[model samples]
Target: MEHLKTFLLKRFRIKDLGDLKYFLGIEFSRSKKGIFMSQRKYALDILQDSGLLGACLDNFPMEQNLKLTPTDGALLHDPTKYRRLVGRLIYLTVTRPDIAYSVRTLSEFMHQPRKPHWDTALRILKYVKGTPGQGLLFPASNNLALKAFCDSDWGGCRATRRSVTGYCVFLGNALISWKSKKQTNVSRSSAEAEYRAMANTCLELTWLRYILQDLKVLQTVPVPLFCDNQAALYIAANPVFHERTKHIEIDCHIVREKLQAGMISPSYVPTRFQLADVFTKALGKDQFVTLRDKLGLHDIHSPT
Candidate 1:
């Protein structure tokens, strides 16, 4: 960057900021204890502007077992407003991953959202209203093992029948990356979908592990990749395959090779302790709160 800057802006005045405190719409605060990222002020402003600052909040971001379908009967008269609102919420996920899945799911119906979809978006806003200060926290830790949890909602989409792939990566206890996207291809079985999800997560995990190694944080001890499906775990552990999983894409099998070579170890975790469950589906209030607390987030009031 210095070399390029010298070439292009040779005579331009520039101030050298030693460290990055904030960038790209995220505010970063570092202290001796830990690093914290919050959009508290921005979230509050958005809530007030959306007329949800005083609304009754729901326990969960979205209702469980709710399947959204195409709005065939009587589409919304003004979907542009809903689309714009959801778009802003999508950007808010930079500091607020708690609403990632809900925002992503709501963003899917941007074209012709109905009243139900709009209400779901409003419900998420209401939930965010009550918890505007929620954000990611990174504690100072020497243990930098790149742990990842990958899961998929098998045939979760009601209209397209496409599964949802969700994953979250942790640098020790700090969550650095997460995603909730609809699968591009139709999967035949749940195991196949999960295998693909793990494969995608492996791509990210491998890249992050490389970057961390470059920064000399931790030597890549076989990254512990957790999944809840036994069949998918077996598929990653063993190279052989039966008729059920043969049709899965070859790219998805790369994680198997990584496992065999000791780059990563696929482990089975029960759904109760699965943190990735929050990203893949709409969870109940108890489960959501449990996982949120486990993510190292707390109410940081100063000497209350």
Candidate 2:
């Protein structure tokens, strides 16, 4: 590391910056255990900007089973505030996957945010207030095996009736990538929605594998891809296609191609053990907390 710095210093006008304590808005702390990353300062700035620094705290980011449509309430008179807040919240999801689903939902109303939408956005801020220092931890471990959990909420969107895809990828015990996104086409069944999600996860895992290979981390075994839907697993493992899967032929091809190439191994996991559930829907406090802990989120500033 020092040699590279010396070579760069000879040509480029760059200072050593010492260590990676802060970069962009992310703050990092290192110890023997591993590294902990958070955007506490940025989170507080958001709360203060929204005039919610002193607001009451919320236990969770969004209400369970709370569905917000584009026309849920009266449109905002001035949408600049709503748009700006949601934009910032989107960036905050970098180290805070706990709010990914809420931010994704709130982002849909950027064009014409309603009063309920604005209120829901502020509620996410309240949840942030409760644990500003909460963030992801990369434990000091040598395990490089990759595993992922993918899930989908069938016809979750009340406005468009589109399914939502949620997935999380882990490099060993540490989470490396995650997403909560709505599907473009409406799925005909829960199995199709889940299969689409599996395809998405396969793409991510494939990309991560290339990245790991570039970093000289070769994966010896096929990465495990967990899903709660039995039908989806069968579809991926089965080479023969059925009439019901014709609509999603492209998605089926992608997952099956990867599975055949030994890039991923699809497996079944129960709904309760599906860590990606928190991203697919607004879960209750108990489930949310349990999954959050499983994701390795911790508040460094909170009392131990």
Candidate 3:
């Protein structure tokens, strides 16, 4: 531990507060309820610095039915500044999944951020202002059932028309792993898009299973992956190659093989219970809050 601290000190300005009460952007508080993570202070500083503290905070980060396209406008006259802002926001994802999907969306345009993109980012800053203390809580629990939720937005990206795949892995009620990523390949149909997303989610689940085995927490029960697409779930259960599925890469078949071997099971879940929905699409304010809370996230500034 001493050597690790020396390495960090030498690389950056050293301000050893003795113990790590906070690191990066997350505020750490330990109690009988287990470790509660929040970023209230960091979120407030970002809002004030971005001059969005006084702006009206919208319940959601982006407006409904909003679309983004490549613009020929001058890409953020100062590219470095835009990059810096993105860097900070990405770090905040450690404790702020509320901004995860939005941050990942803005990151795609980092190569060439236009005025509209910057305005959208500022809007997110304002939204953060309204709920600066919101963060995830890892309550103490022994029932570590490895359940997961996965979903995808069919051709959500306007530029490449590629789909966005998202999944969140939970240990009991605490969200342990989550991702919001754009698929590398484009799908011709919604089912195809969902299949690809499931493949990716399966791969993550497989890795987590192996990781748990290494940690000596291996369970006999198969991991359950809750997906909203019934078609995709059925495809995984059977190996028959349909006309549409044949076009998919051979590597994607790994998911189907894993399912047949009983490593994981893909079950259909209703859209209302899909917690991964927050990572795949921009939702209404109420919907976002509901899913966020389900992920075990709460506002630390609020009285429990």
TM-score of each: 0.90, 0.99, 0.89
Clashes of each: 0, 0, 0
Model 2 spans > 4 angstroms off: none
lDDT of 3: 0.82
Candidate 3 local lDDT, 162-184, one digit each (tens): 99999999887888899999999
For candidate 1, list the clashing residue pairs, or say none. Answer: none
Candidate 3 scores a C-alpha RMSD against the true structure in Å of 4.1
lDDT of model 3, residue 5: 88
* lDDT tens digits by residue: candidate 1, 102-159: 9989988887898889888888988887777778888875377788998998999878
lDDT of 1: 0.82
RMSD of each: 3.0, 0.8, 4.1
* Segments in model 1 whose C-alpha atoms lie over 4 Å from true places: 1-12, 16-25, 299-304
Worst lDDT window (10 residues) for model 3?
Answer: 65-74
- lDDT on C-alpha atoms for all candidate structures: 0.82, 0.94, 0.82
lDDT, model 2: 0.94
